[model samples]
Target chain A: MKEILLNSENYQPGLSIDCVIFGFHDNQLKVLLIKTSYDNKWSLPGGFVPIKEDIDTAAVTVLNDRTGMQGIFLRQFATFGSIKRKDPNFDSTVLDYFEIPKDAGQWFTQRFVTIGYYALVDFLKAIPQKEDNHEIIEWIDHKEVPELILDHKEILDKALHTLRIELNLMPIGYNLLPEKFTIPELQKLYETILDKKLDRRNFLRKITHIGILKKLDEKKSNVAHKAPNLYTFDKDKYEEVLKNGLNQGW
Target chain B: MKEILLNSENYQPGLSIDCVIFGFHDNQLKVLLIKTSYDNKWSLPGGFVPIKEDIDTAAVTVLNDRTGMQGIFLRQFATFGSIKRKDPNFDSTVLDYFEIPKDAGQWFTQRFVTIGYYALVDFLKAIPQKEDNHEIIEWIDHKEVPELILDHKEILDKALHTLRIELNLMPIGYNLLPEKFTIPELQKLYETILDKKLDRRNFLRKITHIGILKKLDEKKSNVAHKAPNLYTFDKDKYEEVLKNGLNQGW
Candidate 1:
C-alpha cells in the first residue's frame, strides 16, 4: 500500500484537499475528524487529488467516503501552503509505526499545498462510515477539537473564521438547523450562535413578520398548543425576502 | 531548460499560481496580462510553485517579477482545478514553438491545479516588467480582456465577482480610488464601480458624515475652492468606524 501511494502516476504530486465538515449539534459548531489506525492520531477527512480529476471533485469524493455523504453545502475556502505546515513529529510516529517505509515515505513526507474546503451539514445526517484504515470517526465541537495531523488544526481554524465572516455578511441564516424544527428551537440556534439573549415576544413578533418561516403541520408543542410543533425555512421565500433586505437587528 | 522543468525535483508538480492583478482606471476595472513569447498568447501573470516556497510567497514573487512590485493587497480567493481547464491548443502551440521533443513537453501538457490570487493595486503603480519569455505585457480593461490562455478567463471573472461583492457588503469604499483625490473623483470612482450615477449633493452629504475621509491640506479643488483638491481615506480610522458598522445605502 505504501509503495502504491509513493508512486506519482496515480495522484497529483504535492497537492491535496482537506474537508472541514461542520455540523451544529447541542448548539455548538462541530467539525468531523477521523482517527487513522496507523498512528491513532486525529486528522481532518482529506485525500490527494487524482491525477485526472478536478480538486473540488476530489474533495466531494473524499467527503462522501468519510461521512457517508454528509458534506452537502461545500465551498473551497482557502489553500494552506506554508513550508512548515506539516508536523514532523506526526510523520515520524506514523513512519515508525508502519516500518515498511524508508524511501517509500517520500510521497507522504513532502510538503503538500492543501486546498481547504468547508461543508455545512445537519449533524444528524452525517452517518460516518469508517474506511479500512480509520480507527475512529467522530464530530467534535470546533472549540474542543483535538490536536490534528499536519496543518489540519490551522485549516479547521480558518474554516471557522470564514464561516463567522460569512454568517455576519450574508443572508445565510441558521442553515445548520435540523430538518424540521420549532420556532423556539430556531430562536435557540440563533441565540446560541450569537451568544446573546433575546426578548422572547420581540423575537417572535419580528421573525413572524418576514413570513419566511413556514408553519409545518405537526403535533402540538409542549410549550405552545397554538403554534405548530415544527417549522422550517421556506428557503426560496426566505431568499426573496432577503433580496429587499431584512433588518432582524442582528 | 525543458529537461530541467520536466524533472519533478525542482518544482511542485501540477501546482501553479495565477495572479489576477486588478486596477481601476478610466472608470473601468483592469487586469494585468502577459503575452508569452512561447505562443504569443495572452495569459495571466503566473508561474509554477517551487518545491520549497509557500504558494502565497510564490504569488508575491510572480507578481513582483511581472509588475515591478505593484500587487500590495494580495488575497488567495479560489482554486481552478477542472480536468479540462487547460488549453490543449495552447500546449501544442507552446510545444511546437519551442520545438521541444515530445517527451520533454509532458510538464507543459499536464493538468495544473492553479491557486487564484487577486491583487487590488493602484493602476498607475503597476509598472509592467517583461519577463525573459514574455513577448508583451499590458494592463487591459477587464471587460475588453483578450482571450486568455487556460481557464484564466474564468478565474478573472471570479476575482471581479468577489470584488463587487466585497464592495457592496462592507465599508470598503472606493479602494480603487487614487491615493489622493477630490470629492468629485471619489464620486466618479464609486459611480463607475456601482454602474450608476449617484446624486452629487446626496453623495457628498452622506460621505462626509462618517468622517472616514480626510481632507489633504495641499490645495483647493478645481470645482470649488471651499473643497480640498485632494482627499485620502484614513484607513485605520475607517476600519475602526466599521467595527461599529456603517450603513452606506447601496
Candidate 2:
C-alpha cells in the first residue's frame, strides 16, 4: 500500500477517478468491488489520476488495473466534491493499513474531488486483478452491495440512476447481456435494471416497435416450459436510430 | 479583477465552477455569456469555488452573482480536466486586464480543474449583473454563440448534450417557457433544443400520450394563422410520471 502511494508521485494532488463496473448474470445486475486493506471495507475500483494523462485515459487505466479488462463501454457520469469527502478518520485508517507514519500520510488526507465513471462489461469475460493491499475482488449483486468506504455507496447509487436513464435512450444493455437472448430474458434484464415489474405484453410490443431487435429462426434449448425464440440486436438499425435520433419519453 | 482575486483568498487553489445558463425566448434557445475585460472575448459565467463552500453551493452562488437569479434549476453535469486547460497566455491576459505584476499573478496561472453546471432559467425574469471585470453581459441565441475563451465552448456543447438527453426523461421545458403556452410553441421548444425537425403529427401524438400537459380553455391571440389551444404543464401528473417512471427511447 505504501508502495502504491509512492508510485503516485506524478498524480494530481486533489483529483481521482472511481469506476462502477456493472455486469449482468443469472438475471441479476452486479457491480465489481474491492476490499480495501484499511478497515477491510468494500469500495468501487478507483485510483488517483496521473498528472500527465487525460482524465478519460486515467479512468480507463484504473479500470484495467483493477479489473484486467480492456475496451469496455465506459461513461463519465458525475463528479463528487465535498470538503470533508476524504475524512481524517479514513486517512488514519489508510495510514494504519500501510504502516506509514502520521506525517508521511498527508497525501492521503488532502481534499480530493473524484470523477465517477461507470462501465458495462460481460460478467464472464472480466478478470479481476489483485492489488498490493486489496487482494479480494468480488462481484456483488447490486441489491446486496454492502456499505462501502467514504462516499462510494452514494457514487454507486448515482451510477445506477445514470444507467437507468441511459438505458432508456441508448442500447447499452447489449454490453451486459449475451449475444443471443430471448424476449423473456431481455424483459428480465430490463426489469432488473429498472427494479420494477414491466408489463410483458407492453414491453414486448414497445421493444419490437423500436426496430433494433432482429428475430432469429432459433429457439431456446431444453427449457421446462415452451422455449422462446431467440433474437439478436440489429446493430445497423441501432446505429441508424442513434444517428437519426429516436423519439424519447412516451 | 485583482481585487476580485484578492477577495477569493479562501477559494480552493485548483478548482473552479463554470455555468451554462440557458433561457428560452422568441422560439429560440439562448445562453448567457460574459465578455472578458482583457480581450473582450466571451465566456460562460464562472468563478472559483471557495474553500469553505460545497461545490453545489458555489455553482448556485456563481449563478446568482452573474445572473442575479436564485433558486434556479441548476445541475452539475461534468468535470473538465485537461493538462493544458490553463494556458499561460490566458493567465497573462488576465494579468494584463487587472494591471497586476507578473510575480503577483502567479496565483492566477496555476492549473484548475473545473466542474461544469447548467442552469435552466426564465429569460424574462433573470437580471444580468455587471461584475468588476465583466461589465458586458449578453444573452446570445444558442446558434449564434461566439467562440468562447479557453474550453468554455466545449463545456457549453456538453451542457447542451446533457440538456437534450435530460429533456426526454424529465419535464424541464417548464423552466424555460412561460406559465401557459400553445402546443405548437411547446413543439418548437423541443425542436430547438433537439436541433432537429420533428414530424408534427408524430410529435403531437407523442407529447399527448405522455399525459403531462393540461389543455386550457384559452387560445393564442393576435396570430396570423388559426389560434392554437393553450396548455400548461400538469405538475402533479408530471411528478407522478417521474416517480413511477415513463417508457422512454421509443
Candidate 3:
C-alpha cells in the first residue's frame, strides 16, 4: 500500500472511479462488494485513474481486478464530488492502515471526486476474486446490502435509480415483461423495478400515449377487477423507440 | 497564468471544470465562449477546481467569474476524460502563454479530466465580463459557433444533445408549446429541437403513449389533412410525471 504513494506519478491525485456491478441470478439483483483488511464495511469495487488512462478504462480495470474477468456490460452513470466522498474516519483509519506518519500520506486524505459507473453481468459467470487473499469479496443480494464505506451506499442507490430510469428508456422490458400482459400487469412490472406504487390512471394514460404496446382484443381472465385488455409491445415501434429514445422525459 | 501552477496545491491536479453556458434570445440558443491572448480559437467558459471545493461549487465560481453574477441555473451534464481532453498543442501553447520553460509548468501540459457543466441563463440579464480586459468573450448563437480549442466543441454539442434529451425529461415544453396545439405541430416541436425529421406515424404513436398531452374536441380550421384535432398538456399529470421523472429512460 505504501508503494501507492511511492509511485504517486502513476495515479491521478484527487480523482477516482467507483463501479456498481449488478448481477441477476435466481431472479434477484446482486451487487459486488469487497471487504478490505483495513475496514469491516464493504465498498464498491473502485480505484484511481492513472495519469494517462481514460476514466472509463479505469473503471473496467477495477471490475476486472475484482471479478477476475472483463467485458462486463458497463456504463458511466454519474460522478460524485460532495464531501461525502471522504471517509469520515479517513485521517485516523487510512493513516493507521498505511502505517504512515500523520503527514506522510496527505494524498490519501484529500477529497476525491469520483466518477460512477454501473455494470450488469451474468451472476453465475462472475466469480468474486478470493477470500484467501485476505480481501474478502462477495455478491450480496441488493435487498440485503450491508453498511458500506464512504458514500458507496449512496452510489449504489443512485445506480439502482439509474437502472429504474433505464427501464423507461431502454428495451430491457423485452426480456423482463411477459409477451402479452394487461395494463395492471404492466404497471406491476414498473412498480417492481421502482419498489414503489404509481398512480393507476396516470400510468395507463401515459403508457397508452407512449404507444410502445399494441392493444389486443384478448383480456386477462381470472382478475378481480374488470378483465383488462391484453397488450404486447409494438415490436417495430418499441425497437424504433429503444433506438431513438423517448421524445420527452423527466 | 503561471500562478496556476505556482499555486498548484490550491487546485485539484488533473481535475477541472468546464461550463457550457447556454442562453436563449431572439429565438436562437446562444453559447458562451472566451478567447485568451495566446489562442485565437474560442473555448467554453472553464477553469480548474480548487483542492477543497465541491465540483458543483467550482462550476458556479466559473459562472460567477465569467457572467459577473451569481446563481445561474447550472447542472453537470458529463465528465470528459479521454485523450482528446488534452489540447493537441497544450505543451507548446500553454507554455508559451505563461512564458514558462517546457520542464517547469508540466502541470499545465497534463491531461485534464474535466467535469462538464451547463447553465441556462437569462441572456439579457447576465452581462459578459469586459472584452477590453483582453479576454474576448461573447454569446455566439449556437448555429454560428466558431472553431473552438481542444474538445470544447464536443462539449458544446453534447450540451445541446443533453438539452434535447431534457426537452423529453424536463417540463420545458410547458412554456414553449402553445396553450393549444395540433399533433402535427407537436411533432414539429420535437423535430425542431432534435434537428432531424422523425417518422410521422411512429412519432405520433410514441408521443400519444407518453401521455403528456390531452386531446381536445376543437380542431384547427386551417387547410390540412382531416383538420387535425387540437391538444393541450395534461397539466396535473405532466407536473406529477416531471416531479417524479419519467418512469424509465436512457
Candidate 4:
C-alpha cells in the first residue's frame, strides 16, 4: 500500500476516524470489533479522513465500509488526542504485518488526533464483512469486550457513556431493537447499555409515561411463558419529545 | 513572523482550537469574541494546537491565554471539519492584513478542523485580555452577536445548544453565577440562557425541587422589591444528582 503521510495530497496526515458500532442481540449489547493483522489485536473500525471529504461524511463512509450498513444512527461524540494514544510498538508491528519497509511505516505510526463517531445499528440487519484480507470482523458482547489495541478501550467506554446519556434524552434505543418489541426486551436493552439492572416496573412506568411508545395489540410469539405485549416507537411522538426534551431520570 | 504550516516543528498545521467563552452579566448572556486584524471581523477566541500538546490541554491553554481565566469550567463540545469551512476570500484577507506574501499566506489560509470548547465563567471574575497586537477582545451580548468569520456563527450556535442540553443534566449554570445569588437573579440567568420566558413560580419551584441548592437565610440587599432569598449550589447534592442522573424535565 502507498504511504499516506508521503502522499499528503489526498489524506490529512495527523487526523483519523474511529467508529464504535453498537448493536443489541440476545439480550446483550454488543460492539463490532476487528482483529488486526498485527498480533491479531482487536480495534474499532477506523480509517484516515481524506483531505477532500468532510469529517462527518468520512465517518459515515468508514461506518458503511466496515459494517456494510448505511444511513444508520451515527453521531460523532468525542475526539481523542493524546501523545501516547498509539501504542509505542504499533509501528513495528504494522511494518511486520504489512511487510512494508520501516520508512514507509513511519507515516502509519505518526501521532493522530482521532475523531470518534458511535453508531447504533440493528444487529440482525447489519451484514458485517471484513474490510481486507488481514482483518477479521466480529461482534463481541460489550461487557465481555477484550482488551483492545491502543486507546480503543477508552474510546469504547466513552461511546457507551455517550450512548447512556443519549438514551435518557432521545429514543435512540429503538434503533437497536426490532420494529415491534416487548417491554421486557426494551428494558433488557437499556439495562445492558447502562450495565445496571433497572427496576422493571419503574422502567415500564417511566418509559410509557413519556408517551413515545405505541402499544401494539400483538404480543411476542413462541415463548415458553406468557408473551408480553409488543410496542413500536411512535416516530412523531419521539420527535416531539426530543423537541420538548425528555427529562426521564434513568 | 514565521508561518506555522512551514514550521511544522512546533504546531500541527490542520488542527486548531476555538473557545466559546460564555459569561452572564447585566442579566444577559454574553460570549467573548476577538476582532481580527483581517477585515475587523469578530471570531471566537482561537489558536492552533501545538504538535506536542494534547487537544484537551490546548483548549485550556487557549482559553487562559485569551480570557485570563484559569481553572474554570471548560469542556470540549464538538469539532468542525468541513472542506468549505474557510471563507473563499479568507486567504487574500490574511495576505493583506499580515502583509505576508501569497506563498506564505497559504499556510495561514489552509483548511483547519477546529475543536470547539465552551467555557462557563463568572462574568465579573473573568478578565478578558487581547492575545496580541493583531486582535482585540470584547464581550458581546449573546443575542446581539454579529456575523462572525467562517463557520464561527455555527460553532457558537452549537455551543449554545450543547450548553442548554447540559444545563438540564448538570449544575453548570453555577459557573456563570456568583457564590451567593438570589432566586430572581438565578431565574433571570436561566431565562437568558434558554432564551425563553419561564413562569416565575414554575421555574423557582422546579429548580428548588431538584434539591441541589442550599436555601440560605440571607436575602438580596440591593433591590426595590421584596428581597428574594439567597442560595448557593450545594456541590455535594449536585454530585449525587449527577451520579443518580437528573431526569427532571425542564
Candidate 5:
C-alpha cells in the first residue's frame, strides 16, 4: 500500500488517546509499561491518534503495538489535558536516557493534548511485542509502580477507578483470567483489586446465582487444602448478565 | 469582579466539553437547545474550555449556562473528532442557517475538536438563559428534532444510550421527576424512556427495595382512581444505594 500523508510536515492539533493496559497476576493488580525507544524510561502503553482513526481506535492501536493483543475489554476512563501537561519534561526521561541534545526534545514534546483510556486483558494472553529499537516491557504491580514518565500515574489511577466500577457492573474476570479457573482464584482477583476480604460462601453463591459460571469436575493437581472445583465462564450467560448491568457485588 | 473574556479567541487550543441535555415531557424525550446569538438554528448546550477548568468542569459550565441548574448528574459520554468532523458543512444545517461566508466558515468549523457529555434533567427545573447572539431557546422533542446544526443528532443518540444504561443500573428518576411523585408516576417515567411496559407490582417492589424514596403519609389528590402515596428522593439513602452497584432489574 502506498503511504498516505496529510500535511506531512505537521501532526494536527486535536485530541489523542492513551491506553493504560491493566492486568492481574500473583494476586496483585498490575499495569503494562514500555520503555520508550526514544528515551529508555518507562511509559504506559500508548501512541498518537491516527488521522482517520477514532480515539477509541487510536487507543486499541496503542495496545496492539505494545502487546500484540486485540479485542480486549477497553474503556475510556478520563481525559487529561492542561497547559502544563504539554511541558517539555513530559518526555524528559526519554531525552535523558538517550543522552540527546536539549533542543532535540522539541521535535517530540511540542504542544499536544491527550485523552486517556483504560483496558483489561488476560495476563497470560498478552504477549509483549516490542517495536524495533524499543526497550524491554514490564508488568509492575500497583505498589511497585515507579514514577512513570509523565502524567501516566494519574492516568493509571483514573483507570483503576473506572475498572472498579466496571467490575461491579460486569463479570470483569473474563478479560483477566484463564478460560477455566477455580473459585479461589476468582476470589483472589477481586480481593487484589478491592483490597478487601470476602466471605467465600457468599461470593460463590452470588457468582453461581448469576449463572455465568459452569462448574467443571476437575480438581487441583496439588494443594495443601481440599481442592476447589474449576469453573469456566458461560460466555452467553455472562453476556446476558452484562445486559442487566452486571449486578455483582464488589 | 473584573469581567473575564470567555470567547474562544482568549483560550489556547485544547479540548472542550459539549453537553447534550435531555428532558422527557409530553410523551417524548426533549433536548434543551439554543441558536447562537451570532448564528441561526438550534444546537446542543455547550461551551469552551476554561483556562483553569478541568474538562469535566467545562461540561458543568455548559450545563449551567443553558439550564440554570447545577449539581445534577452529568456524564462524559464520548469524544467526537474525525479529520472531516471539522468540515464547514460538517452536517449542513448550521452552514445553511449561517449562510456561511465560504472562506471563513471552513476555518472556524475545522478548528474545533470537542468531547461530548450528556445529562438528564427535569424540564421543569431547566431555566434556559441565552448565551450567544442568535440565542433562541426551545425544548425540541426527539421525534420532532430537525437536522441539527452539526453532529448533534449523533451526540443526542449517544446521550440516550448512556441514559438507558444508567436507568438499568440504578434508580435515576431524581433527575426526571418532580419532587413529589407516586410509584406509578415513577414507573411511567421508566416505561416512557425504556419504551417497555413493566409489571407494576414488580416495579414498585424493586424501587422500594432500593430504599431511596421517602414516602409521605399523605396520598395523591384528585385522581380518577385510587391515589398512590407521594414520595420524595431520600438523598442519604440514595447515596448508600449507589455503593451497591446493581439489583434485580429495572
Candidate 6:
C-alpha cells in the first residue's frame, strides 16, 4: 500500500481547459474542431490553464484564441478524469502511425484533469483562427463528427447533452442559429439537439408564449410551401427570461 | 515574474472537495454543517481528495462519510480557487492558541484547489455522521447559518444559486423533502431557497401539472385549518421528466 501510494509522486499532475464550441448550420448542430496541423488529428480547441489565471478565464482565453469571440455564453459543464482516459492511445486511430511513445513520451497524454466548458456561438460570428499555427480548423456537424484525436468525441457528446438539458431553460440555441430564423428553423434546432420530433403547432405555441421572439413580417423567400414568418430573439427579453427561468419545455 | 513564480514554490500544494448538502425540514431549507473539531470553527463537511481516486468518486466518499447517504443527488457545481483562499489560517490559529512554533504552518494553507459539489437529500432519510468523531455536526436553516470558518459560506451560496436556476427543470426539491409531503410543504421549501414568496395556489397548480407528483388519498390529520393532500414523487415519472425536461414556470 505504501509503495502504491508513493507511486503518485511520479505522476505529473496539471490542469487544462477545453472548449466544445457548438454551432448550428443546415438544420444540424455542430461543434468547432481543429484538424491538428502537426499530425492531421482533429480535436476540440483546448489549451493549458495558466498558473496566474482563473480557470473560467482560461477557458475563455482558449475559446478566444481559437474562435476570436469574447463574452460568449461559455459554461463549465464537467471535469473529465479517468486514469485510462489519460492514455495517449486513447486518442483516435489517426495517431496509430505516429510512432508516439507509450505514455508522456507524447505531450498529449500527460496526466491532465481537464475542466470542460461548452460555448454556444453564431458560427457566422466566430472568426476561427489556428492557434500555434497547427492544422486545419473545421466545424463538423454533430451527427457526422469524425473520430477526433483524443477523447474529444466524448467531450463533444457531453457538451451536446448539457445543451439538450439546458436548451429551453437557458438562452442557448439563439447563439447557434442565424440572427433571423423562422419558427420551423428554431424548432428544428431543438429537434436536432434532443433527437426527437415535436408537434410543430405545440412547439411554436410554446415558444411564442415565452414572449422573447420578435415576429418579423418577412418570410422564407425561396421555399415552395407557404413561407413561414421570420422571427428574431429579443436579446434583452431573452436575458430576462434566462435570469428568471421558465417552466414549459425540456 | 520569475522571482515571484519561484517564491510560490515555498507554498505546498493540495486538492480538496467540498460537499454542500442541502436539507429541508419544517418548510425551511437548511444545509448540513460540521463544526471543525480542530478549532471549534463552523464549516461545510469537506476533505482532501485522494491522489489515486477520481475527483468525483472522492466527492462521493467525502459526502457519504459526512451524511451517511450513498448515491444521493450529488453534482459537481463549481471549482473555487484564489491565491489567498489558501492562507495558513488553521495552523496560525492553532499555533497562536497553543503558543507553539509555526513549524507545521504548511499543515494549514497548503495551496489547495477544491472542487465543490452540491447535493440534495431527503434529510429525514439520511443518517448524518461525522468523519472525525469529534466534529460537531448539525443542520442549520439557510438564514440561521453561522459564519463558517473558510470560504464555505460562498460555496453554499453558489450551490443554492445553481439549484434555484435549475429548480424549474429538475426534480431536485424531492431530495430535500420527505417521501410524503403536502403541496404547501414543497412550495415553502422553494420559497426558502429562492428567498421569495410564491402564490400558494399557483405553485400547487404548476407543481401538479408537471405530472411527477403521485397524489395519495392521505391527508394531514391534525394540522390547523384545512388539511392538505399528501403526495409523493413518482420516481419513474420524475426520471422520465428529467429526460424530457420540465420547462415552464414564471
lDDT of 4 at A6: 39
**Top-scoring candidate (DockQ):** 4
iRMS for model 3? 3.8
Select the stronger candidate by DockQ from 3 and 5: 3
C-alpha DockQ of every model: 0.46, 0.60, 0.31, 0.63, 0.28, 0.27
Top model by lDDT, which number?
4
True contacts kept of 4: 0.59
Q: Give the per-residue lDDT of model 6 (tens digit) for B22-58.
A: 8888777789988755665688887654445677887
* Off by more than 4 A, model 1: A1-6, A90-104, A173-175, A194-211, A217-220, A224-230, A238-250, B1-6, B37-41, B90-104, B169-175, B196-211, B217-220, B224-229, B238-250
Superior candidate under TM-score, 4 versus 5 = 4
DockQ-based CAPRI category assigned to the predicted complex of candidate 6? acceptable
User: Candidate 2 residues B187-243, lDDT tens each?
Assistant: 898999989888899888988888999999999888888889989999899878766
What TM-score is obtained for chain B in each of the predicted models? Answer: 0.81, 0.89, 0.69, 0.89, 0.83, 0.84
Q: Interface RMSD (C-alpha) of each candidate?
A: 3.5, 2.4, 3.8, 1.6, 3.8, 3.5
Could you tell me which 10 consecutive residues in candidate 3 chain A have the lowest summed lDDT?
Answer: A1-10
The digit string of per-residue lDDT tens for model 5 on B1-250 reads 0134433344434345678888867657788877765445567777667655567677787788778988867878777665555536455454455554444333344445678888888888888787545558888877677766667778888778777766756667778888898888888888877777989988888888878989889899998888878999998777766665555445
Q: Chain A alone, TM-score for each of the models?
A: 0.79, 0.89, 0.68, 0.90, 0.85, 0.82
What TM-score does model 4 achieve against the real structure? 0.92
lDDT of 6 at B32: 91
The TM-score measured for candidate 1 stands at 0.85
In model 2, pairs of residues that clash are none
How does model 1 score on DockQ?
Answer: 0.46
Number of clashes found in candidate 4:
0
Q: Mind giving the per-residue lDDT tens digits that candidate 5 earns over A37-147?
A: 665467777666655555667778888777778798877766776555664545566556655456655535543467788888899888877654546788889878876
**Clash-forming residue pairs, model 6:** A37-A135, A247-B247, A247-B248, A247-B249, A248-B247, A248-B248, A249-B247
Q: Measured by TM-score, how close is model 5 to the native structure? A: 0.80
Show the lowest summed lDDT stretch of 10 residues, model 1 chain B.
Answer: B166-175
